[model samples]
Target: MIVLKAEVFNDGRHTGENIAAKLETMLSSWGIPKENVLCIVRDGGTKMKKGISLLIIKNIDCLSHQIQEKFENEEDPLLWWKVNSNKYGILSPVAKEYLVTPPTSVLSERVFSGAKIFYIPHRNRLHGERASKLLFLKFNIPSLQFNY
Candidate 1:
C-alpha cells in the first residue's frame, strides 16, 4: 500500500463540486494524469455520488462502507486484483489503483497524537504538504515489511 501524498484540506465549503475541484488539483499536483484515474473509491454519501459528474470519474464504493458489519472473508484485495487485473482489461489497473491505497483505521486519539507530534504550540509551522508526508509515513511505515 502507498500513501502517495497527504496534503491538508482546509476548504471553507465542503460541497461536492468544491471537493471534486480540490481532488483534481491534488491529482494534477501529484503528477497523476486524469486518464490514469479509473474511478474514486469513496463512501456512499450523496455528496460523494454528486462529485462523479463533476470529477469526470466513476465512483467505486469504499469496501469498508460496503461490508460494514464484519469482514468474513480473509482474502487480500491487492493479491486478488494483481492476479486478475488482466482478465478485466482496463478495469484491472483501475481496481489495482484503488487497492494500493492505504486503509484508514486510525482512531481519533491517535490522530490527535499525530497532530501533537507534528505541530507543537510554539513550533506551529508544520502544516500543509510537509506535515502531510510526515504523518503519512508515520502511520504507514509500520505496516510495511523490510527485506534486508
Candidate 2:
C-alpha cells in the first residue's frame, strides 16, 4: 500500500517535520524503506519541526477512478440536454419566478429539524405520498410538448 503524508497546517498549528517523524516511525516498524513514502509540504513561510523538508515519491493512480474522473470532467451534450429537460427536475417556470432552485438541501435540513418538532398528525391519510408527488411536480414543472 502506498502511503501519502501531507502538511495540513493552515495557521501554523502543525508542521511537516513532525509529520515525517511520525511517518518514519510508522514505516520503520513496517520494514518499509524511508524512500518508499511520500510527504507533501505546505506552501508559505511556515515553521515545521526540524528535518522534515521535502520527500517526493511516485504512486500509481487507480485506472477506474481516473477514468471516472475524466468522464466527470468532460462535457456531454446529452447531459446538458437532460439537465435542461423538464423531466430532470431542475428548471421550472413557477420555480424560476418564486423559488430559486430545488429544495433538496432544505428538505434534508427539514428532515433532521422536523424530527425534533411535535408529531403533528397529518390531515389526509395519503398526505405524505401526495406531498411527494406535488414536490415532484413543483420541481419538474411541466413544459408543453410540441406534438409535431
- Stretches of candidate 1 off by over 4 Å are 7-11, 67-148
- Per-residue lDDT of 1-148 in model 2, one digit per residue for the tens? 3554333444554465655565566666788786754433333323332334433333223333332322354666455444554542333343344534455698756655544332346634545666666555544554534343
Taken over the whole model, the C-alpha lDDT of each candidate is 0.68, 0.46
Which one wins on TM-score?
Answer: 1
> Tens digits of per-residue lDDT for model 1 on 1-148?
3566665557666677876777787788889876667554565676756665687775565655543432237988767767665554456677777667456655656867896787888878766789878888888777886433
Whole-model alpha-carbon lDDT for candidate 2: 0.46
Error of 2 at 104 (Å): 49
Model 1 worst lDDT run, 10 consecutive residues: 63-72
- Point to the candidate with the largest lDDT: 1
Clashing pairs in 1: none
Model 2 ranges with Cα > 4 A deviation = 1-13, 38-53, 59-148
Q: Model 1 residue 81 lDDT?
A: 67
